[model samples]
Target chain A: MRYSGFRVIAEALTGHKGWKPVWRDPAPQAEYDYIIVGGGGHGLATAYYLAKEFKQARIAVLEKGYLGGGNVGRNTTIIRSNYLLEGNEPFYEFSLKLWEGLEQDFNYNAMVSQRGIINLIHTDAQRDAFTRRGNGMILNGADAEMLNRDQVRALYPFLNFDNARFPIKGALMQRRGGTVRHDAVAWGYARGADMRGVDLIQNCEVTGMRIENGRIRGVETSRGFIGAKKVGVAVAGSSSKVMAHAGMRLPIESHVLQAFVSEGLKPFINGVMTFGAGHFYVSQSDKGGLVFGGDIDGYNSYAQRGNLPVIEDVAEGGMALMPAIGRARLLRTWGGIMDMSMDGSPIIDKTHVEGLYFNGGWCYGGFKATPASGWCFAHLLAKDEPHKTATAYRFDRFLKGLMIDEKGQGAQPNLH
Target chain B: MIINHPILGPRDAQEFVYLGDANLMGRPDGMTAGIEAFHDYLYNRDNPAGAHRELWYHEQGDRSWLVVTRNTVTHEILKVEMARDVARAGGRSK
Candidate 1:
């Protein structure tokens, strides 16, 4: 079943009984050539690309729970390449390009909206900083526009432009950056991989790794022992605990990041907007619910929930940005675990164990970097070398004092 | 989250900044601890799902650091004490 306008019409005429399940729920195989753990966006995307691009077979993705049950489904869904660092800009730009053609490639309706994103500028120094960032984006072959106060006001007149403390001065806009249907990404990649003979084993928790003489043999799971020639661990927040099975401690800490949505209203917000002076970003969904998020809970915990103070803080930021949001009734809030690294950048490299690979420490960038992270991780696994765009994401970078500290916040996972 | 401050009574947790693992306050003598110990001190921690002792700075309050013993699973604060008192009780001087 190829999905298209013709197929939709045919299915409609036939009373819509011809549709099949998106992906199969296959049982675990006795062994596989490659086993990727953590069936979130990155793991599924890696399996899809490994089968599609690298032409690998006998691939299986092991998930502890159902598909799309992780950060892939718990994000704010904003996508952009407006980074300021060389180590990050090109890679994210590549991901943005992948998001542009994702629906066509996966044969799914992902709703990749390029409604643009604006980082509001509140001060003179912020304008200068955004100028440098915009220039960096352009240099990295990504689109960026520095908008003046009038231009920003024209785009989002609801913003509090006359605040005495944090008045809106201008903004840095990227017309190509926007949101995507987050879970659809997971489903599409899972369906594509499954179609290509890749096994997706859900509810199979890996308990331990069977290492022989510093090399990988396979994994010990709750179901049973499954042999594998190569293993890739892409567990997002569980990176530390999962890799601990192999006695490798990562320089990553897990923290809870909360997100919220408002009661559905008439469509108003046309694009994604972030408050410069604070940690608040919001965009309206197609259903008119305002999706937004702020800072993390700022603690080391693996819980998938947050407390009230952070909620109040996020609501304060929203109210400060747009007083009108105060009237909107709150719908709900959720949390995702962020694998914050020492320097706030991700690590995608092989472990000391010969046949084992590790890919995590994504922090806040995991959802946005899904496609490129998978593409680069697959390239590394297939070729045993870092992809050109991801060369800086080496595990040894911190040991060699070559950290890609994008936030310029040193060695603190929580600060990052 | 609300922390019942010892001196200030119940206060919103947002007034504080979280620093993981109250064990971070125990600084080994640099001359005695080797690189391996330092590495373990800096990078390794026991992230349990139950009660955890963490440091929180009252940034919007008295600027005192509090050692908050809370359960990660339930998001419940067990106890809160000034970190300076914890440091002194363990025998230290400035």
Candidate 2:
């Protein structure tokens, strides 16, 4: 059923009995035209666009666990398109545009809040860098503003301006960037895809892939073997293990990135703010909790947990930036397995194997790229070519020495 | 996690920069092994879930590259030693 203001009012008047499950629970089919692994935001959005835009038939999404059980629900929920590189800026800007109309497009309350985001600058060199980045963002049809120290102070007065170690100099602000309800994005896309006759099967772990003469026949799952004409894998952290079944070693590493949330308090933070000198970024949730995160645990593993050293480092950064947060007690913390690529950018290209496609290497920036990732990935799967906005996300870029090194780090997955 | 360094006292793992697989230290002589061997050394490496020996640089400490033996599954550091000593022990003193 379509949701609207009238429906909400009527449901409230009638004690809300007409509410139903967001999407249907369906069994896996024996065969499908397209099979998508991993039922997170990207997978669901890809399925939605495939059925809605491409008009594809017999689509199925298989998930090892329940939907939204991965990084889609475990992220910091911040969304922005303020990038610098030619390979990344336009694509993320497209994602931000899609995020602008996301709630209305899916008929779900994803809570796409466009309050804004500010990346704090600490030194003159950082100011120059941000100036160049701001110009790059503006050139790519995205909004950006370089704010001075006084302007930043006007926005956030509680920041530690007196800290001499990493002084709060200025910031680069993107007025259209903000946060969204991460799980709600998964739900909305799942509902939309279900309405388009896409079957979403949960608890179906893909054990192995059946390849015949370099062509994919189907996948062997926990339930049983399901045949498919084409298969696309988008499992974020499990990309390496899953792709290894096809005898392909990905240039991706799985790292655990931790996030935290403090106890509820009065509204303090008006927008998202990230520390420039350190690896801490924070925003206040609508529930009044300060949601924040820091760097990934620099190790390759599939575990969705982190140790204590990174926690101490993150706390030090937070205290160094905003000492007021020291009073708030941390309520909970969680980790998401990040598929970090070599050059700190993502890859959305076809593998050497026929009938098998891959979309991963999102690193810590996957949540913000959800909408456009699905759009471009769907375009690629339907048309058998790279999307215009995503032509730089190629698997052969590294082989050709044309790697899109966004962070300027060469072949260091964890550094990304 | 706290890693007890051989030269230094117990230090936080955050101060060290992680470089995967201590096997990276044993770079094959490119002049003799050719491109294929270099390619194998660069790309083909086992990613075990259990005990792994990796390269971690003490970037924020003594500027020493330490070969750290740690368990990938449990984040436990089994041993830590300077990479220069490990390289010399392997009879590479260029």
Which structure among the candidates has the greatest lDDT? 1
The list of candidate 1 runs beyond 4 A from truth reads B2-12, B28-40, B43-45, B58-64, B78-94
> Which pairs clash in model 1?
A308-B1, A309-B1
lDDT of 1: 0.90
Poorly placed runs, candidate 2 (over 4 Å): B2-16, B32-51, B57-69, B77-94
lDDT tens digits, residue span A106-215, model 2: 89999999999999998899999999999999999999999999999999998998788788889999999999999999999999999999999999999999999989
The alpha-carbon lDDT assigned to residue B67 of candidate 1 equals 95
Which ten-residue region of model 2 chain A has the weakest summed lDDT?
A398-407
Question: How well does each candidate superpose onto the true structure, as a TM-score?
Answer: 0.95, 0.93
lDDT of 1 by residue, A118-200 (tens): 99998889999999999999999999999999999899888889888888999999999999999999999999999999999
True contacts kept of 2: 0.24
Q: What is the C-alpha lDDT of each candidate?
A: 0.90, 0.89
